[model samples]
Target: MSRIGKKAVPVPAGVTAEIAGQAVNVKGPKGALSFVVHDLVAVDQSAEGIAVKPRDETKLARSLWGMSRTMIANLVTGVSKGFERKLEINGVGYKAALNGKVLTLSLGYSHDVLFPVPEGIVIQVLGAKSDQIIVSGIDKQQVGQVAAEIREWRGPEPYKGKGVKYAEEKIFRKEGKKK
Candidate 1:
């Protein structure tokens, strides 16, 4: 049995759920998200909430059942409440700004790097210093992928600790060799 799959997914009052063949469509105040049900996993709408069941007790099937249900639930919630990721610029002179739909980053480079923000993703600069960037979107995967790509532009250096990083991410500094 899958613990996560057994959990009931609560449906908000304004949200509407529809089952179309193997696809499930969830419509909420934010938007509508549809997902295809897997063969090993079965989804059913109940008066209380949505329930997911696995066809077999095998390890792979059980895991997939739970993960698929969780992913579907996340999609519903994301379309309703949305998701956001924050990245901090650690080095001096490193900053970010939004020019229309383009994100301009200055990561101690000779030239400022300007990247166009993808559709459905919003970029915002926090504080007057502009050292903080907030990426918000309805899709969790897209938001994370965008953040990762931005971070890759100027990944944190082990020696100088320069570049973009998550707010809670820790950087390990190496000790200098004795002269």
Candidate 2:
């Protein structure tokens, strides 16, 4: 019933995948990652690539079937090509800079905000005024999490739309108060 679950995850060339018990491990040029499939779902690797099936016809099993398959696919793609998230800072004197393992953000606050970069993740400040921040990592979830944390520091306002926001994000502008 799950269209996505019915499809097998294709393993690209130059990537190595291993299935051991309920865990799936993948190694590629970018990095290596592993994931444990749920008991309700069954996973197997074949010439066509990885396959996922529900253990039973129960709702829970069906629900987990597609999710498990997608998770495995993400792991493969992540290790092969990795993931990236970009953030754009707006406002006067607002900028981002990376110092060693720490990220310094100036968002018009009294003091600069410091963010420590975690292992396995790289944060780069680009753009002419250092307003663009790019977060990249082999893990899709981690890369997104790090980008979200940075954006949370100074979210875009509805009025001026000033603050940190995703490069592709659009902020809805609100009309100013009229006397």
Highest TM-score: give the candidate number: 2
Model 1: CA > 4 A from native? none
Q: Look at candidate 1 and give me any clashing residue pairs.
A: none
List, in order, the clash count of every candidate structure.
0, 0
Taking the tens digit of each residue's C-alpha lDDT, what string does model 1 give over 1-179? 76788787888778888877668888888777788887887788899688888878777778888887887788778778988999999888899989999999998889999989999899999977899999998888889999999999998878878889987789887776788
Which stretches of candidate 2 lie above 4 Å from their native place? none
Reference-based lDDT, each prediction: 0.86, 0.95
Best model per lDDT: 2
TM-score per candidate: 0.92, 0.99
Weakest 10 consecutive residues, lDDT, candidate 2? 77-86
lDDT string for model 2 (1-179, tens) is 99999999999998999999999999999889999999999999999999999999999999999999999999999999999999999999999999999999999999999999999999999999999999999998999999999999999999999999999999999999999
